[model samples]
Target: MDIFKELQERGLIYQHTNEEALRKRLDSGPMTLYCGFDPTADSLHIGSLLPILVLKRFQLAGHIPIALVGGGTGLIGDPSGKAAERILNPQEVVEQWASKIKDQLGHFLDFETKESPAIIANNYDWLGSLQVIEFLRDIGKNFPLGAMLAKDAVEARMSKGISYTEFSYMILQSYDYLKLNEVYGCEMQVGGSDQWGNITAGIDLIRRTSGDQVKEMYGLTMPLVTKSDGVKFGKTESGTVWLNAEKTSPYKFYQFWMNTDDQDVIRFLKYFTFLSLDEIAVLAEGVEKEPEKRKAQRTLAVEVTKLVHGQEALERAEKISSALFGGGLTNLTSAELEEGFSDVPSATIESPEIGLVDLLIKGEVVTSKRLAREAIENGAIYINDIRYTDVETSVSQLERLDGKYLVIRRGKKNYYLIKFK
Candidate 1:
């Protein structure tokens, strides 16, 4: 598919300057484009994935992408799209987060290649070195205060008030474009729809600050991804679904995608996966025909989970899901069994020795010792997957998996873990 068509198909392009001209330029040769991500958090949420994915798309289509970690701009928070002035984070915190964010992004881009390789840039490199006089005399002159104030982001805050720090956000962002253009001949910037103003500011900066001839620059923004029900995409009641496994576990991440609304599965597949249009069309058709089967949702979940994490994590999550929901647990490794059972309600036995009746009572699996004994007499309990008919049988840590965890199934779907620690 053509560049513009493919991007539009994937719901990537939101706004751009001169699409026809940009398309022509793109066809002629590789062009360098960049998107900046601030280090406001240690892990980038799904909100940030749109731009990162789009950048990867550009690279796959034979272009160089520069991912700018907002180490510098992060210190001076961007006021665009914010309701109120954001709490400024310490410079050291921002720096540390910036490093972490860059490392996460590294997994998605190809940096080892010499041809159209992706580059990581820190705006701090230039922003840190600028003297106040030089910044005011050079970059500050081009950005008129009136124009900056006229922006919606700024005007909306006029009632409350805008800080000098925030008011200068536009200038700083615009200078990023100018810097990219001057240093790397970067001709385009891409970001979410919220960044339109800052992107325009950047284009304006490049045009005014560059050589005698007005240089052409472009901006592209993706639409804000909001669910049909208006729930913010990629967030759960638990919190933001982070790309970092440590922040959001692989099982939780997989579950997030698996639970996507049937209506949103197709859109998410397009937005999140590298699958071709034809392939996604097939999945779309399946989603339409047999949504009850959740064919598309499962594929979307598996592909995205594997992409973000890895194949091994995807397999592990699948295994855990199967063991938890499919009533299948024989194949689970001892370690897998522990990870899967970690969150289940647990009752620990101080001395890993107890009668079946006492074990059931202690585990709260049964209401009382009488009921526990009756359950054992009725062959309702199992130890190590073996049916228990002996009311006097004793349970011990010897039956636990890896000598630590005991998988207890109270009923068909009520599973619990017993720890012997």
Candidate 2:
């Protein structure tokens, strides 16, 4: 299938300008396409996945992918979907964020390919050197004030109020496209639905600047991902799911997808995974025939986790997940325990030997010694997946998995971690 058709099948093509011409251009030969990511945070979140994956798809199809880091634009945040002005980050902070984001983007694209190697560019290199008079005379003159105000980004923020710094973001992004086109011969730009205004503005800038020289420039965007339950996708009660493992652990990231709603699983499979359409069709059937199996959700979780965090991390995450479900914890390593119980109720004790009731009470796993004793007698307390019915039974260092950690279960679901210092 053509690259465009493949993207269409995956439900990735939200909006594009001049589809027929773009298709013809892509069909003719390799075209350089760029997607800009502003470093608003130290790590990119799940919200940024679609654009990154889109760039990957294009690269796999023999097109040059340019991952543009918005070092300059990061200083002046884009107000595309914001209700209020963004707190500007220091120049040093933005540069640091840009460097980290550039490294993360490297994982998604094949930079070492001899043919059509991926390119990483920073807008700060050029934008920083630009003078106010030069910007006004060259780039600013091309964008009409009426059209700028009419854009959804500006219109939405008009009532709430937007600063000149943010309002000028579109022009900066447009200039980025012009610069990329001039330097790399980039013919296309892609982003999420929220960036439709900015993407189109770039296309307009390219046309106006190059006139007859640049006959066709393309813009494409992906849909704003949202859940069937009406909540935003890529978000949990805790916060956004970050690509950085330190920010959001591999286990939690895997669990996020593993818990995908049945209603949204098949769609997410198509959107997120590189699995063939036929393979996804089989999973879709599994979703309808046996929702209890959760095969689709599991596959989605495994594939996405591996893509973001590597194969070893996925294996560890899977093992940790299984261990949490009473699958057994005899083989769990200390590092796995640390990751698995990172967010669970935890306490530290100097000595490894302690009575079950005392440990429970001290760790705040149970409110009182009396309650801990009652829980033990009632067969509701377990130590390392083994039932502990004796309140006076003492946990020893020998019982600790990996000789350092203990996993205590208060009931069927509530678990606590005890660390032996």
Candidate 3:
């Protein structure tokens, strides 16, 4: 398979140093390639998912991939896409975050595969030890002041007064490429479009330093994932959609994709999923014919959620999601209950046994016990989505989900969670 062509067809390739050279190199044989991710956050978001998947695509196509975690540069902070300087974190905190990033990257790439085992390189291993004098004498000398100032990343920040620390980021990233090339024989670097400047800097550094040994080092970048509205992807009203289920529950993760706009879902499938172009073409037809059924959106959600969170978590998410609308809440675990109804109105009680009218009042389902009784008499009150018509009965008579909670549906849409502490 022509991995280069596949990436291009999927619209994953934003820019490349030399398409002809890169394609010819990819066709000749497997070459080592690397992509860097800084430990800017504790968990990787949907934005990082694209390049990580692209790296896996290369690995599946029999190329060596190096997942470079920027423990070194992370401390310095890359200013390529930022509007202002970043507040530096302590060295220990950055190391801890880098360790977490390494774990997340492991889920997608196959390090155990014998043919071309993926390598995880920490720039800290080399960058952490280099003396400032040695860095200036060796790496710094190769980067021309004019060239550094001309990079779009640096140029844009120059008028706003770019700091020396951020201005030096390009050279630091360039040294990473030079080091990886010498150590791993890595010939290519891939990143988001924002890193175009840093990526090219690295390629040039490799050429200048390696001299005759320079064997066609290349750089490629994927488009910065964006919404149809042109806002950046991976954020919601709640915050970043994190890969860690603890940070963003699996149910929420599933919903994030399930909620992809009609205009964005098809393109997202191509960018995020391993589904073949032919299969995606069929989905596109479905989208054109029946946007109401949302088949394409569901497929994209299922494919991506399963890829990231596995079948079991995917099943849990689907179960809770369906139950919320279809009245199957009994099958869910306590943790699932919390995740499913996290945004719903909740009231806590000291005991599970409570008068139905009083419970409804306590749960804030109704303004008063009289209103609660009225709702019950009218058969508008539901316990765990089952209509409860008896105003005299107590909540203890109705089954408590997981022995501790009652899901009260006041009417067709409003839901209130009553928790027994």
Q: lDDT of all the models against the reference?
A: 0.85, 0.91, 0.89
Poorest stretch of ten by lDDT in candidate 1? 396-405
In order of appearance, the predictions have TM-scores of 0.87, 0.96, 0.92
Error of 1 at 408 (Å): 5.0
The order by descending lDDT is: 2, 3, 1
lDDT tens digits, residue span 44-84, model 3: 88889999999999999999999999999999988887888
Better of 1 and 2 by lDDT: 2
Q: Write the per-residue lDDT of candidate 1 for residues 202-308, one digit (tens) a residue.
A: 99888887669998898999998878777888788778888998887788888888999987888888998988879999988888888899888899889888989
Ranking by TM-score: 2, 3, 1
Q: Report clash pairs, candidate 2.
A: none
Give per-model CA RMSD: 3.5, 1.6, 2.5
Q: List the residue pairs that clash in candidate 1.
A: none
> Which one wins on TM-score?
2
RMSD of 1: 3.5
lDDT, candidate 2, 215-254, per-residue tens: 5889999998889998889888778899999999999999
